[model samples]
Target: MPIAPAYDWVAHHAMVSPDRSAWADIDSTGDGAGLACNWREADERVGRSAAMLRDDFGVGRGDRVVMFSMNRVEFIEVQFACARLGAVFVPVNWRLTVHELDYIVSDAAATVLCADPEFGDTAAELTQRTNVPHLVVFSGAGSHPEGSVDYDDALAAAANRIDADPALLPVMPELTHDDPLTIMYTSGTTGRPKGAIITHGMSFWNSINLAELSDLGRSMVNFCFLPLFHTGGLNCYTNPAAYFGGSTLIMRTFDPGEALDLINDPERGITHFLGVPANYLFMGQHEKFATTDFSGVVTTAIGGAPSALPLLQMWEKVGCPLIQAFGMTETSPMVTSISKEMAVRKAGSAGLPGMNTAIRIVGEDGNDVAPGEIGELWCKGPNITPGYWNNPEATADAITNGWLHTGDAAQMDEDGYMYIVDRWKDMYISGGENVYPSEVESALFDLAGIADVAVIGLPDEKWGEVGQAVIVKSPDAAGSVLDETAILNFCRERLARFKVPQSVRFIDELPRNATGKILKRELRG
Candidate 1:
């Protein structure tokens, strides 16, 4: 017997636990009201949405549907609907400008566009510019734009039209694990973002990897506030929890104070939590930070980048351990993660590789490096992506001999713990010596009065290139604001003289993409 598509799990869940909570969506518009849906409702809702995509929009197998929305029930429904029909769902970063979105939609040859009304101007402009045949608009009270279909109306109509109809009973196509599920566009820190093809198997394997490592179960209640366009938000804990019959609280936008309040609520019994390093930092700085009860949180995971030791120490006060993970959009977003059991001991490390994942740190010769030596990280696993969409050259460069070149410079210790030094492109040569900015930044992360910092190489007349430290100071820091001298002294104590930043520049905050990873390229400018 063949395995059914992942979407069929929703129906299975509905049959087993029809009234069990599936997801609770928090309003993003600053209002506190929420909408809760059970497994049965979710199954029917996705089925209706799928019917609309098939009957109304003419979406079929292998078609591409682009979604431009924040984290909402509609976004989840659309993704399932697309999967039901064997169509690929392309989730674009709503934070992206119209120009960036245009390239992805056009490149994917999307047949239909589904967007939230919050991005009305962008959606209207995109439809006019691209070959997208149908536009479905969702969210808010008033009618949808002039020519677009209102999301609520569309699903309700489809439900009413197809209710109790035997012909429309099997709206979903026969799909296998190898079928493409989504086209997640990378955050293009270097250039134009490429759409990474995510298969059903990759997603399923990642869920399995996480469930085994994190001990996720039906009793687990996770929270999601990250943007859905990235794998960190979609595949990380959200989909994994949903896949394992757990409940998830989805927030449309992240608010540090609001998140603190939610976590502190005793009734929610929020067990599993995941956030980028910056999120933990912000929440640690919130006014309620001192009073928030974190005793209920089982596993607090951090990804997107290696976390600062100081941030981890802060969470330690709340009786929570911050688990650092390392991955990219290409690897279904999970290659290595610090397990809950080893989180404290391997505090700063990316921890061990996933159960089915193999990680290698290869030097310039494309051979595995000795322990403690930095090299490009290569991953081979069932969870790894097949390749990028419509870009064979990029795909060829990314995945070779069934191994996905992660493009991240990493070092592994004798105990098999991995450390992500920096991105290959982000590593720069200063004074004829290799300088990984993350190494420098990690040393500065524990400094007094310093909130955040990013190091970049600047062209130098004598050294070819030199390091520049961009700093963000803690708001309530006492004594005095740190200067170049203080920063230089701090790094001088912790890092090599050549590795120390040549100059220091202070800023209010670091610029980050939607997923909260520092945008070092923007800082370099």
Candidate 2:
């Protein structure tokens, strides 16, 4: 029989490649115990977990179960269990505040929440206000909160005997290509967050595209350090790696030194790595950076923020080309990427659209713009999301005529190479002249004493809005003053006079949302 389009990867892999290594987690703490699981073990655990969800917790088809934890072996197992049982998995960002977590749980209508002990306090505060009926704690050495179930104990309570027939579980409904599979909440850099409804087909298609685009075969082992709650980490890396029968070296949390150690480890056989630019920046500056060997890694995917040209050059100096990609949680997180070959030639451009994708630049009048003219980027593809979970007005506004309006202003060259200017909402008009923050941020990146910088428009009575550059000075440049004159002088040489920042403020760090994207909304405030 042919494999179903809505195939369960855990079930398929267990049947086909039972003995293959599926996932490995290194204990960063000095416990001397690491976690490893093969396809067979993963499938059994997921199945047993699913039975527990059904029999014990009363979780079944169409129910929402939220997983609040960092990267761990059980996270993947629980995700698979949810998938197999036709339940929706909502992975909450552990970094969110209690109020934020409460809002999401209430908004998503998640009935069950599986949390790690590390977040017990946050979960306790949220559960008090929300309607969450069940709480299961995993990987915690501490006592469980009252009315909460221990994850390991729950799993053990379920009979260890496998289901009589692997296919006997409830068949996933005849889902349209657009039916919701995962509801990933937006990072909410601008305002209140909304859940982006990712469909089963969207996730599966993007994973297939990524596997083919990156040439990820069975022998490849991918490194995942980005939070699994984010689309780039979950759909792009973990889900896809499982689809192709490849292995994933799961990092519970992102740490530059630990990541470098994992990359240099010969036993892990890590061939593919993906991370945000901040990770590369830290790793490149580490004391042992030069001596670390990355000859085994064939591809390094970097995104989530604009990488400095200097940082890319630094990685190149170490014999690795960081392929830049651009996508949001709404795009199934794989919209466009700079191919390995083009990474050298096009330093900052997020390369052409992937297979089966269409990209166009539209002006305020909703028509395509000419080459080199900045306009809002709109994308349409199988991978593009149908709409936000609820909020029809927002959905209608974001998706018009079947194209997902990206809200990012960009320009494309004659050869179809695209360059991101800035978010449409982020671009400010000063003195009747357009100012893209990315332009100023790029220039700031070249400055000697800058570690990080974000440009925002401050309320100005004269120019309507004046540019304010908020900077985080490098550790070496600490205790030194970075006055507005110095920044203005630096920009005067690189940018037009009107585009230069009118004011400069020294900050410890730019504010960022859960996904690590700079929160200009907070910065403006």
Candidate 3:
């Protein structure tokens, strides 16, 4: 197969189909605040913003810009603008703390920072610490700091026409297949976050695969509620939607009532939807869920955590089959996905790998494991990241030969279906957000009277796995009682709110192995 040369997503969309609906923000509150833009409008905004960035903000090719915001129309527009300018886009997870946020911004060396009103306070704090020259506030409603510029104001100042000098402009670069496009910071499980360097070819190939696999094209309508910062949302929703010229219903935040209303309405044209198990669980429990008609839903992809059998059954009863999938940020996020044809047969499996993607279960010695035997999941494909940014040692350890070592314990059946058994890393995913045990442990260490802490995941009815911290306090701290609120408050300052432990238990001592390693398995009991 001849490899197609790389092209920026914005350039590709503008050249191919300029009038198709590229993105839209659905009004979850039923207000008229919803925003929608077709491909032409999206291209114009990106072009205008690119020109403004070059002339006003001094951004050019190879420069990095950080976009910190929730799931909104502007979030997608900023990404397009970055691509148009040939600048590497770094999207910060909005839930991260000031410390984590500052680390990523500095690491990316972002010359320009764009933020939504909700994150203005954190952005203001970051601007004080970094040499970022420009700050553009989105949503048009925020009180800007003294030096910041309004996003709408910048767009207004931009020329309506694209500049003639394509080479002098940012989008004219000859983007090779391997050239870096986006640097996504993985939700670090054990230590500080690592930036996964993604290329134009890798992202484009994954989007094509997803579009073909999910039967998404110009005729399909996709409802995207996942955060664009995550691979699941970007590759699956935004990229694929652009690839097929399909319409997308975007939501800045996931609301059960609003989601139900959108899916049930026939005019919404929602044929496909994707979310984690927690989303399905929450929607399943909503009072209107049972009454709402989901007959129009063709496919619903559920992942992040295992989907409970009961939840699957509930969706099936409403004529919507749930397909479970398994992937990580490193593999361009799509490894194995449950196919619609095998939806009922392979109830728990994450299906087989897509075209040209290989999956294997390897033991400690790097040999393949037998069928039905548990081992670390390893993947090799065009979609896999070349390596983690600026971490050669870690990258060497992670990618053996060409296979990306996924720190997930999984089993494969005789028919080649993969089933997730457990995670090798001590990472708990609550409501689709990756919560690292080390990050939570570091926060717990700051508590004044804390002696030792071990954080583990416990099965929950809503969130697939809620964080449970078992603390062993000092002898003098025996009389000190620790509650959920106190421990959560302590974490809020150092970590994201989602990473905070939902429950805290004061134990005399945590189970430790002979080598003094905290035994999380025993702690789970």
Candidate 4:
């Protein structure tokens, strides 16, 4: 396949629709608004920002430029800038501890570290330990070391040196679609964090894949509240809008009422967005949710986890249908998605594969399973990541014959829609019977008095392992009435004997990662 030459899509959109809005940064805390740049201005900002990175930071081709900042419009600027320079942009989770980030910075050997003002001290400390060559305060420059670059001053200087409207990487014409666009690190729950190399090809394919499934076009206004550090944030709708000439409403961070405010506002014209189950749960439970009119909103996707029936009904009542999607970081995070029409008709289903993507449910024997049988889900497409960065061994283990082993247990129904059961690794055998915790959790959701629940396999005296239920009781549940015996009996009536939990442990809350996925590893103790 012939690869397209190196370039940025922002430039093309700017030329085609110069005056159209490309990005709108909404603070959501105060007036609930910020910078709203049209295509022409956004393109100029990206060009000058790229120049600043190249000239001031000495950033170059193949170098890693790691950014540690909250959800701001500058993320788009820096990412596109890196692409313009033939460099790789790396966005780290702001919620991650300094020690956790140190591992990623050192692993990537990041040349230039850019961060928001609040994290300047953390960035400085990282620089000290990793001894990174350069550091730049991404947005506002606070009391940091003198050598650090301020994002605004650097861009102004770059504008003075470069053309008013500049051409990006005219000399590096050989840069192609397969070149590294970003190195997104996976949530290192199981082991060490592996940097998934997201290529320019995957970015384009994801946009095409999303467009194929939904009405994401020039007029699309994507409301982005998810963290840009994750694939769901960047590739989900943010990057797709950039590719299709649509504007993105970038929020500083997630705030339920604040989100409702923007979604309800007619002027913002927020059309499409993506969120996890927890996001919808909160938004639905919000006092303002009762009045949330889905008139301006077209499609808001759900991922990270499956949506419960009540959660699905909550949005359905308000006229917004939750399009449940399934994917991970390595696949550019888009594998399958259900349509709004099938939102409840096929509730809990991940729906169909994208036009450019293919999926297979392979059983333990490495053969395709019959329509309703659960098996490991494997994905292949232009959207799939090539492999992990600097970890060839890990890469080789992840991909086989151009197919990414998604490690997700799923099944395809007769209608061709896929149902993601649970993580393949999360499945445990009880007395030789496979037990998917998600299945148990879903069943438990139907039971009253249970606020939240997670099931894990524990060592057993006779059976190889037995299911253990870690639960959070609803505040209204009468005391002692919802004890271990009652819960076990409730499961016994619903689940197979082997699937029922042998023991129950109640907790105030369930531990979750940034994306709201229950931390099973943390629960194992």
Candidate 5:
């Protein structure tokens, strides 16, 4: 069944549950704020946004519409608008350098770049370099780039045009499973980022997989603080909210303290949330963590990196257990998720695959590994991405037959639950023994006054490779005399001799990418 003639998710919600709240924006000030819209408003906004893209920006079906922005309501609006207009949307990470973003914009061949005002200069530069026909800036505090269209003004004009005649709304294109819904660039280790083509079917199936797994409902209120460009933010729960006629509170900028206050506010009624471990880690370290209420939050999920067991345990003790999940950008970002019930019981597990998805750990021979044996993880399902955009060689290497070769080392227990060991590239052989850095990091997180930590392999004379601990001291340990010997002793108490980091270096913070994963390459460099 086509989305238009039989089952348009957004249109169905507009008709059946028009008054249901669909979205809100959480501004940066630690004060509760910004736009709120219901399903009816959402449909109209999507229509108007699509109208603006087509009539004002000259975007057409199959054209790439690129967005470079932080977390905001406008990002999702443009996403829906592109889908409605039958254009393949690209959400470029706002944290990328101009050069990196330029590469993505050129590769995507975007006709119009809808961006946040904060990135006005970059957008203008991209327009000049890429020859983009239009640069539309979202309405905000920052200066609008020269000659760029104001998003709000364009939307108003689109509304007027639609009022003059509703026919101005985009005519539904005959889309198929092959039609791309989005192109998300994944920053894989050791190479330039590759744009993964997430198809319409993948999005739809992911929404279904996540909704059923997370117990999503029409009344649920999702707190979306992750970058809208990341699949974790886009598909995890935000898209599921739209799919189920639910609501979401968007974050213009993520601040741990503000997030804590908002999550504790009973009036806002936040039901679900998701974040990378760093997001949760900072929140747990905040002064507000001791008292901020978690009774209102139905569930919160953690992914993007392996979380420290103690971090998960701390959240569990606070009555808000963070559900550990496993996924990547190419998997529509919801390959598997642990339920709240299993969150504590299976504290270190990534849990089972999504109901509609299938994942397996395979040995070097490309056959399934026995339970408890570590192997490269592979996944296949409707929710998985078709392949990378434009790069057929990379696509051919990544996806074998119908399966995506996820370069993650993982193991499965007898119960069928999965445990992600570590990235194959990240796992270093210490004296001929494989040492997973996450395990060492997890043990080290149990230490107080340690805000953040990352373990990377360093070449050694005696051993082929050895672990190096990069520590970010919390405020309590700001000037404390915690020397390398003490840290090594602490790890020696918890880990095997081979797993302990050979060196310890304290720093103010770890170098984390936009999605919250530690940038080990930078550390190695």
Candidate 6:
């Protein structure tokens, strides 16, 4: 059955359980100062924000409101407010430089821009290039550009008016299930970024997929340390948990030590957690990692990229089985995920196709391959984006015959589990054998003294290309002076000789994008 086209989960939950905690935000100061809002409070705040956007900025249906800030409750509220008014919310990556941000803001043609105090400088620079008419500083003590208002003041004004007479707020436009909900820009690993048009229905279905896959319940307490701009943080678990009447505790930004303390705090009672593999890696390497207790966590998920086997084993050793998922921004960010029950049994598999999701592994001939044969994975589902926001050429190239051809090379076992081997473009053939960097990195991560690692194929004379490993050795290993020979020998025991990295280089850290995904392209360069 289709969800009601006009239904708003926030509004629905606010009405059904007015007193239930909807969202919680931790301060970035790392002092544990935080704030939370119940459903009723959230509804009122969202309504006020909608009123403010409509009245103050003339923002309404089809208009874009760009949020360039770090994670916070206001970020989520602004997004919901945009939903309430049928406006598209574009959450810019705060990690982006001013030039990159300018392209997104102008491309989006956003009328209102919101910034966090931490990014006041970037936001200020953006106003000079983009024609964004209204600027609001959301959370920070730093001074904003001229003519900007404090986000809190804007909301308070609206709330005061609404409190006196709720009827003053403009009537929300009737929306269909297909109304645009968000315009999430891709990470642009290969080319210029393109906004993926996410619809209300796409968000709804993705939440359903998450709830079913994770067994999310009203009692689950989700800790969201991932950035909200990404689908992993927005639609993956946070939104789904909210839809199920569960509470989400969000960190203003990921602080490894702070996250560790939260997980150990019995009062927080964190039951569900989600992050990229790098987040888990950093947390595991933190000084207190060995002493922290993660036993209270009922569900933990890893996305962005496949996690290393050693990282998986580390978390499992602490009684927190980390389930790996495969997705991208184009598919409402979730196509397949390993369920908690099967986390250990199918440790590396991306799991089964999600609800209302179909998968096909197609070979070069454009035909379905036999089970266990590697091919490009194509997905068709309600959660898949309609198309890229403005680039029809890119959209046409991406979606065909109702299937989004995810540029991921994968294999499906006889039992129907999907193992994402590599990005189709990332796989390199060496001596007629296919070598996936992820596979090699997983083996290297299993070594006793490795902290982080990235692998890329480099030109070779004997073979067309050979694997090169870039590693960040653990502190203790550095003290012991672990060398390339140990890493190569470690791989020889666990992998085919041909698949082991032919060369190794040590680095203080790996180059990563804002979302904690290692930039292999940078490594290759």
Model 6, residue 523: distance off in Å is 11
> lDDT of each structure?
0.81, 0.77, 0.79, 0.82, 0.82, 0.81
Query: Per-residue lDDT tens digits of candidate 5, residues 273-365?
Result: 888776887788999999999988888888866667788999999888888888878999888888888887887899999998999898999
lDDT of 3 by residue, 48-150 (tens): 7887778788887778888887777777777767777677788889888888788778878888998887678778888777767778877545446767877
Candidate 2 lDDT score at position 337: 80
By lDDT, the better pick of 2 and 3 is 3
Name the weakest run of 10 consecutive residues (lDDT summed) in model 5.
1-10
| lDDT tens per residue, model 1, 208-321 | 888766778888888887777768788878888878888888888788899999999998888887777667877898999899988888888888655667788888878888
Q: Write down the lDDT that model 3 would get.
A: 0.79
User: In the order shown, what is each candidate's alpha-carbon RMSD?
Assistant: 10.8, 10.4, 2.5, 10.6, 10.6, 10.8
TM-score of 1: 0.81
Pairs with backbone N, CA or C atoms under 3 Å apart (clashes), candidate 3 = none
Clashes of 1: 0
TM-score of each: 0.81, 0.80, 0.94, 0.80, 0.81, 0.80
lDDT of 5 at 287: 100
Q: What is the overall TM-score of model 5 with all chains considered together?
A: 0.81
Q: Tell me the spans in candidate 6 whose CA falls farther than 4 Å from its real position.
A: 1-4, 28-33, 426-525
Clashes of each: 0, 0, 0, 0, 0, 0
